[model samples]
Target chain A: MVEKTPILDTLTYVFLVLGILIVGFPIIYALIAASLPIEDVSKVPMPLIPGDYLLANFTTAWTKGNLGTQLINSFIMASGITIGKISVSLIGAFSIVYFDYRLRKIAFISVFCTLMLPVEVRILPTYEMAANLLGPIQSLVNVMHLNWLIDWFANYDIDISLNLSLLDTYPGLILPLVASATCTFLFRQFFLTIPEELCEAAKMDGASAMTFFRKILLPLSKTNIAALVVIEFVYGWNQYLWPLLITTNPKMMTAVIGLQNIIPQADDLPFWNVAMAGSLIVMLPPVLVVLLMQRWFVKGLVDPEK
Target chain B: MIKRSIFSNPYLPYLLILPQILVTLTFFYWPAFDGLINSMLVSDPFGNYSRFVWFKNFIALFTDFLYLKSIGITLMFSLATAITSMSLGLLIATLANRALKGKAIIRTMLIWPYAVAPAISGILWLFLLHPSYGVVALAIKKFLGVDWNPVLHGGDAMVMVIMASAWKEISYNFVFFIAGMQAIPKSLIEAAAMDGASPFRRFWNITLPLLSPTLFFLMVMNIIYSFFETFGVIHTMTQGGPGGSTNILVYKVYQDGFIGLNLGSSSAQSVVLMSIIIVVTILQFKYVEKKVQYTG
Candidate 1:
């Protein structure tokens, strides 16, 4: 290995600083805008430092925006979707990878193909399907069904109706995201990396499919599960367009929606303090998750070759 | 692992994939069929739920000036974002691949935007360019003495949307490009350099051609993603404003179905969009797959 010249090293540092500033500018700007005082917010030359209105601004946003309720709604919605995506993905991945099947090629291709269609293209039909399923259950009396079999269908409607309304309701925020091809794809790729010999040995030992999956596959793929969990969690947490479409109840909004709704409608925008507070509140979880994923996300992104 | 009878075992895999199949069927295939049927019925996106009047939606879509404009805009947005972001991504990946001091820090910083939700990214940009008292707005007004208001103009808004989309996508491309670069053996580069190939010559001959497979994978994804996912940015930033100037096909699908309550037309749009994507993806696999070199 050859050592770099001092001039080349200095240039690297210079480029790094520029790169950091470019990436960090918006985030820093958001923080500043969220923390500045109301009066100073509209000044021609924006203030460069944190101002005094941080607490009051946050308090106003918290109370008027109903941020607490939204946070809980977001948490519940994200959790439901994450559980659905992960469980469904695991089942699908296990079947495709381990099972000796005739339809393997078709199944694998279909799952891979679905990756080309993102959320928007699929939203229309999914909306209609969701609408047809949830239209009746949205009614108050129908939501009260408590019988076991009926309850399962009832829960589906509850989930569907909540997502359809795009208003203040939990299901409305979560249902659309319950299934994700990306999650499935990631699991499939990871599952492919597991040695097939282990499964063959497990089969010779008479381990059932479920047991082998649980004992061998699940433990082996822990890192992928963790990666997918974090990715899905962040996705569900920061989800905006679908939630924006369905939820009408301001109080039922998720944290992201709450922050968006907090934009002041007055002739002048609100104090930077409140905007900053709202942004900070909505931004934290995803940032923390990204920090967690930095180690694994890179590796996963590159593993298609394997 | 269970090693049941082969015939019996095939069903197990099918059973495993059943949930996905059902969900995909319900959510994707059903709507696709519905859209195909609806596009032929001369109804609005949600209205005219009556008998079949086939090919009417496609006909109308072709004839309508607004629909035509949307097609043009969608192509422009997708193509521009794809080209610009791909090049920028390659450049950034190259820089990061130097693995010089603090390259890891650079990589982390590069990825910061990927963590910021697309919706939030749009909002942040909107705030920065709020035209009156925003940061970028003030900067332009002060430094250039010209007020740049994207809200009022279609052309300006379209350019802004593409730039914002590209900005967010650079991180995506960077991640994949770096990975692709990493997979290339350093020995190849060393061999090229020892043969008296210049740095630029080495990269063009050894680096880029070798990186093509990863580049190709990302290219297909970039096009597909621009078509479908950029709608979120359009929705949050422009809302297809200034008289439908920024309305891409996917956003139009949303508008026709959810906002305009025109399910039939929206379904038609969905069918058309999906068919195009499927065809394009198949072409990639058919033609480009042969060129991908998976060097470990």
Candidate 2:
């Protein structure tokens, strides 16, 4: 025991309780506001407890605010991005960590260079690339005189255009994000811990690298895969700036982007109850993922380099 | 950090890592290089006529008062956020580490806020601090008899954003702090206690010096986060409004490039921001990964 100071122990408890309340106050406030009726919520000093109008406020936020479509869009985008990022980084990490090849160091360095170039830094050019990819593709096709290729695809109801923009599409949202520097970095670190004897034994048995990966390496990385999923899913779900920039249509808005719309301007007599309901609805999935998968969440976040 | 190859195929490794390499080349390097090139090009309003203008955009950006103000704002915001979040995080972590009951549950509750989106934290704070009809704003008006209008006041908006960003980051700092504290050997602390060093004295002398590495790492992370990741916070909360008082560098780049349509200047800003990131990254590799030591 450090000490038997009852006063200090009580202070510690008090500090912990206060910390929890302060940390949780926003969420608690959102919930209470979501449940309260408009009249109650409009008052100067709103009630702090949950009210009976939870379902009503939720229906208003969901149906009227167009949150349902946004939520679905968010789910689709998040899943697409998560799958894309994980698969790409998985194979990339596999080759880099477990194999020796030409320009291996160059490949590793190129991926590592991305750590310094976040989306925010490369904002304008990335937007330009996503919005105008057809320019270069068309020039290549024209130079190669591949008009039949276009006609061949056109026969199947696929009309390729000179101004083929990917904005507001699922692939558009996911593709630019699929290349994850840290994912490969972390997975490669994980693969290094796998014993060298296993690889030597597999070689002695005449097993190919792909077979070894499928049988031994994949199964060995279940924890890493799970941790990666939680982290990537949250990341993809919470994307704000990229979606806000690319998707101009409200129909394609993710839940996070939908937040800007749902929030009312200060001058208006906005329904605080409805906005609070929408906020809670937006936060529900990610928060639930954290609470339910608490251990994996902690592991993924704390030990990123492990 | 190098792992020997289990297989000996030249084509297979290239095939495996090709997808990530292609994506990185397409998205990251190309755009970054484009930004660098764009900073050197002089373009008209429509970009219909552009000529090479070496260093002119950079000169324009360095001389602009608004750009300089944004730089100052970013520095202040990052420092304020890093200090407040880390201190509060350390305080809570110490308490949680010693508390007797519901320790796991408390840690869970404390850490879940890390999953909340930065924009959501912005909205949450906005809800509480909005000038008209905001709950906390109303409380302030009634209790302190001051007009608490973050919407109109520049300083108030800055404070609101700082609070929101720090709130979103506290859980992250707390988790790392707890991990760092737990890694310290118990015998050292027990021996110090046996030597009659008071709890406060022991903490100031022993725990702090030992936790310096984690402290340095988190400080760097918090600074980087404030520089780039607080875009959502500033966007959702202030939108760099009230005459650009809360406009950080990231927000300025976005607003200038996208909204203001000054591609050259925006690209210049991006170049400057990228340089900052490069320096910070180097610091992390040199300090954090190197187990930067502090003598007790």
Candidate 3:
């Protein structure tokens, strides 16, 4: 066994310290800036000491920036999206992994192809289609389609219109993103890792496919499900462009949009304290989710190795 | 084995894939297909496309100097960032791979910033490097004493963008590299050491060559990720600004499609971008893949 050199050990510490500082600086700086009083903020070479205005700053950001409503908007939008995406991905993944059909290869390839295509390119056409096709149908059915039989099953029908003014609306934000490629991919990969013997044994016991998946695979994939939850939550929280496109009303905006709005238009602007406060608020959920699921993230990363 | 009932099974594999199938058709493939169609026609007042104009947008794209320059700039940015990030990642991974104390703590801290979204990372750097009142700005002014502004300066902006992006990216790539390196059997390295090889010599001869397969995979993925996935940073930091010096093709696609209200042109640009990536990917698989051995 070879012992480490003193020089190497010192170098490692130095490298680690420097790397940690560089990485942690933003959040650290944000915390300090957000906690500082307005008077202290004016000091040149801004004071490094923690100030006592944290509550005041939080109150200001909440009311002045309307972050309360923004938080609600973001939660509703993200939750709707999460539910829709999970549902679609579960169904899609099950089909891709379990079903034996012709065009399965094409389905897989098309999904892979979607992974490479930037969402920006399709924004325009999607907007037009959502407005014309989905909007109209939804509205048309909402009135006449909501009937006595409908009272038994589900709540509403699709809206029918060519209008796209529903940008900030929940349906507007949620409808276009009902499916996710990454989730599907993850599910497929996880499903493939499960031995077929369990499925065969279940089949021999007279279990249906749906029953097998629900009772067997679902329970076995607790880790994957946890990983997917954290991943989906983080993604939904940090999403920027699509939400920005679909939502124009300030009341319906997310924390991300709130962060953007808080940025000042002038030089020597953005009022670092306020911006930092807002950024911290917006970043809190994702960071917390990651921290809680830190083990899951590590496992997710390593599982690919196996 | 061909069960006749399987063909008419109500819930077919294709049906399982139907939601995503519809999503892809309506969103990705259909729009791309529509773009190809629209490229041939002019947009009318009623939103109706006119008669065909074959190869017009593609030809126009070639003639446009700015578009061509953007394509070139994107390639440069992707290449520079990928190489810089991968090299830094390898170095960090190698360092982390040593029998070092607090390595787990170091790994956690090193990867913390990667949890920060790309948009936030750009903003953090922008604030830190702001010409006035920024921590780094004041230090540079007091020490170097030259007017150091990242905004209005092209070279500085590019360097800042690259540094910010590369710093963020290295952590991600390093995670993969570290994992890859850890997977390598320690006995191989010890066996090489028994042959009178110095640590440095062993690293060069044994460690690096063995890590090449993972490195190659990283190289391909990192390059592609940089090419398409860097729009968030560009959009937030420079918005391809300081006289369009930082506008990569993907950023240009965002600008053209959303900002400029020119869907046809944006689609044309995306098609070109797709072609470049596809070709590069194919070349990597066809040529470079044969040279490496993935033990896993």
Best by lDDT: 2
For residues A51-108, could you state the per-residue lDDT of candidate 1 as single tens digits?
7666777788788678888888888987888788888888888777667667777876
lDDT tens digits, residues B198-281, model 1? Answer: 666777888898888778878887888678777667876788976788899988888877877766677678777888887987
Model 2 segments beyond 4 Å from truth? A134-162, B142-145
> Each prediction's DockQ?
0.43, 0.69, 0.35
Tens-digit per-residue lDDT, B99-184, candidate 3: 35777777776665555666666666666666665676677778988677777887667766776677667777877788877877
Ranking by TM-score: 2, 3, 1
Candidate achieving higher DockQ, 1 or 3: 1
DockQ of 3: 0.35
CA deviation > 4 Å runs, candidate 1: A1-4, A100-113, A134-175, A265-273, B1-15, B44-49, B142-146, B292-296
TM-score of 1: 0.86
TM-score of chain A of 3: 0.84
